[model samples]
Target chain A: MAIKEGIRTGGRSARVQASVHAAVRELLKEQDRASLTVPQIAARAGVTPSTIYRRWGELAALLADVAVERVLPDVAPLDTGELRADLRAWTEQYLDEITSEPGRNLMRDVLSSACPGYCTNILRGQLQVILDRAQARGEALPDIERLLDLLVAPTVYRTLFAEAPPTLEQLYSLLDLALPGQDPATLCHCDHRRR
Target chain B: MAIKEGIRTGGRSARVQASVHAAVRELLKEQDRASLTVPQIAARAGVTPSTIYRRWGELAALLADVAVERVLPDVAPLDTGELRADLRAWTEQYLDEITSEPGRNLMRDVLSSACPGYCTNILRGQLQVILDRAQARGEALPDIERLLDLLVAPTVYRTLFAEAPPTLEQLYSLLDLALPGQDPATLCHCDHRRR
Candidate 1:
């Protein structure tokens, strides 16, 4: 994160930016996202509140920058040659990542911001990775964009609002419904059907 | 509301509860949900903070009661006797309700609370109405429980996080994807396919 932040603008300005980003991340580790304030962030970073205000204008903007620059890129889906396997594996990992204390906080911070096209853009890219690999193997995939509603939205909803996040079993159940006749058991060793 | 509260208990206690709920709803009309504080709520409700604290213990618990008793139940999905039309109409109405300032605040309040099973309980009941009607008409449906992911999640996600909520057009697009063989145009007069 420091390297990426520093690479954009070298020297003291870059150092300040890195520190601010670092401070945001560090504070997130110890506290809820809603509790974070600009003055607190500035104090943690050893920069004046004016510096943060001048650079990012608002907490939301700073959080958006952190998301685009640091967080979303790390959420890229991996290629495993098979679409179903890749999706199931990716979904599990994605859930694990997002439901973690820091991950949930960071995601909530990003989503709560008014950054137009950020969530869909990052999600589309991730889904595209899985889709492209599926299409390469001559599998007839549905419209990649349409799959977002089926694949991404539910898990996100449960994570944010429901008392507990959707279990892997529940996710597999959704996949079974979405891709009828595409047995999830064939894709992975997990016997979610028994559950 | 007073009548409903009074039925549960009676007299001054019921009046106090009614006043507090009314105050929360009224205050929500003018301000964003995140900005509301317990002291402000107490002042508006014409009650002491100690009374509120003693009764509800925290802002989240109080908000959860408001959601359960008032907001969520009002989101009942209607039965138009046509599954696709009913789903679309319900989704649109639900979207309108949730995205409204007061609706959004109440929903955010309920979600941010530690209330277990509240979201799914309400949403499941709503979705079940549409599903039961669809099945009764001899339309083969996917697993009823899993449908929430496809039907409800995307709209909630876009409403809370995205720059814009999902349009009726985008929703039809999703329905088209979910119910592959069923044309939304055939079910309703709206010609989404031409788009």
Candidate 2:
């Protein structure tokens, strides 16, 4: 079943997916998300409701598919020549995006889906790019797993469940903790405490 | 509505809730979860299905309520006199419980429910007890929010989504990170790494 789906991801199927996703994005921006229905989405996408049902299973699954696409980083994280600067830049931008209202909704949709690994891998890949850049520059590399555990996990957990999102200072502190002895002063321009 | 529910918790309503929850727990152990229904649960508890629905709203919510009860730390975390030992003992026990098969299922039920905050607060409260104990001992207290972000968040994220649950060593390492300058050698008996 998985292979069959994989085989059909081109030409007509790909076009249908792209249009359907675009329609969902536009509709989500313009209307209340709770009011969205399959038929409305199909009409907007120039497809029948049956087409959506046959391809994506249901509204929740379809939303998850679109969310998975949106959350996946389309490009490498920005390179700032220094490891601390690069990590700060990438992490700050990441924190900003995921904690936004739309990003939180996307997170919920993706989590509700059967597959969360797709989004997890996208995040890990982006972090890996930054780590690789640091290594290439002969800077001491921070452990990726540590970064995930200490930084990404907290950021995500707080975003999803905590009363409020973590601040920029909190993010910098986490980065400092994750990469001990890395000079927190050089990590960010903000006047947060340096451990 | 909330006030009404609170007022009703003392008499027949409480008994019905107790019996239903007990029935659900028993049935879950004896049968496949997907096959069990409200009718079966109601029959086992000697109550009508309508009673279960009226009180709990639905099967998912009922399951979540039961899970929330199960996961709440019934007693204070062990006080081993020292701050590091107390943290290790509490966190290790927590990790062992929540990463088990039944624990994972309970986590899913709680998260799927409308009020994840109930479970989140329970966890935070448990950690706060550990921290408060440390403070009374004149031990420098680790920030509770930092502990939640660094320790609880990663433990949960890994339990819910990662390919594998984090190991005892990983938990120790996180504890070490969250409370830096604390002697890692004394944190856990296992020889993972000091730094």
Candidate 3:
């Protein structure tokens, strides 16, 4: 999907877009992000500064557009035929990807961008797909917001801010909490009284 | 506590620290952050540039220091003689402050800083105090990590990224999910299959 609606996506426009995105990716690997400028990016992409500005508005917007494309899942979440298992697999894979070096950088770009909601919507859409499949199978599930609050939020928060990302087992426990009738107690091994 | 360990906190040092921090806060209100330079801050604070460089090391470090001070809780979370009530009250107040304009700006500053974990630790410390008090009352409660994963993480994540900060009622449901023996289904009014 286009990062911004109403943008033309025909042949030449698409070619310029790909070249500019590739330039951004290459330059990010080569230099500090704060040093990246539209003129510099345009020069590297073999396009004029006006073209870059006309298409993407500014450097932050350009970076955000690239980040959204990088982060959007290329395939639907795997169907495990069970809601909990499906959620577990999806979340674990998400955690792994986001905690990687490039993933973390993309996350910062998206968050720092003017349109952070694009990335948020992408994530919410993925979870909604999982929840919808579960419902189709006659399985009871918590609402999408519940999953966002308990599952996606924590995973992203820990990945970005904590000393380390949540473990696979911790991801399972969070999924347990979000799914109906799953006893989170059985999955939790820590003593409640221990501070 | 000092933002960096071993920094002197008495007399001239304290005065310089206050002045420099005040300068940053003032400049942030007065001008675009990307255009702000250490020399300008030092000029405004009436301190030499070397002094700022010596103490804070750089602008991001200085900004992180100021953000931590701004975001840290000024008082203990109020006690309501019950674990759930206490958590709910504390979280509601936390949400209010973080979602406000100044709070939102401070959250961005902290997240963008070089030492994000300082702010993270401050938040964790506050939650630990609440959990400790609940434990003292002989109330069964989840561990500190559980609180971070289920409550604090989502609160921070949504405040920073979502379309709007979560509502007090939504905060209540999350607290319900975190506390032992509390049925989240009872508090969540939305239909699970609706989405």
Q: Which candidate is the best by lDDT?
A: 3
Clashing pairs in 2: none
Error of 2 at A189 (Å): 24
Q: What stretches of model 1 exceed 4 Å from their correct place?
A: A1-58, A64-76, A136-138, A176-195, B1-20, B23-58, B67-76, B130-142, B173-195
CA lDDT of A11 in candidate 2?
90
Evaluate model 1 with DockQ and give the value.
Answer: 0.30
- RMSD to the true structure for each prediction, in A, is 8.3, 8.2, 6.6
Task: Provide TM-scores for the models.
Answer: 0.66, 0.67, 0.74
Give the alpha carbon lDDT tens digit for every residue of A1-195 in model 2.
011121125699789888999999999999987899999999999999999988877787787767656664466788999888888888888788788776777766765666545456667778888888888988877788888886777777777766566788898888876774455343322223332
TM-score of chain B of 3: 0.71
Better model by TM-score, 1 or 3? Answer: 3
Better of 1 and 3 by DockQ: 3
> Could you give the CAPRI-style class of model 1?
acceptable
Model 2 DockQ, alpha carbons vs. true complex = 0.20
Top candidate by DockQ: 3
Candidate 1's displacement at residue A29, Å, is 8.2
Chain B of model 1: TM-score? Answer: 0.60
Span of ten consecutive residues with least summed lDDT in model 1 chain B: B1-10
Give the fraction of true interface contacts kept by model 3: 0.42
Query: What DockQ do the predictions score, one after another?
Result: 0.30, 0.20, 0.31
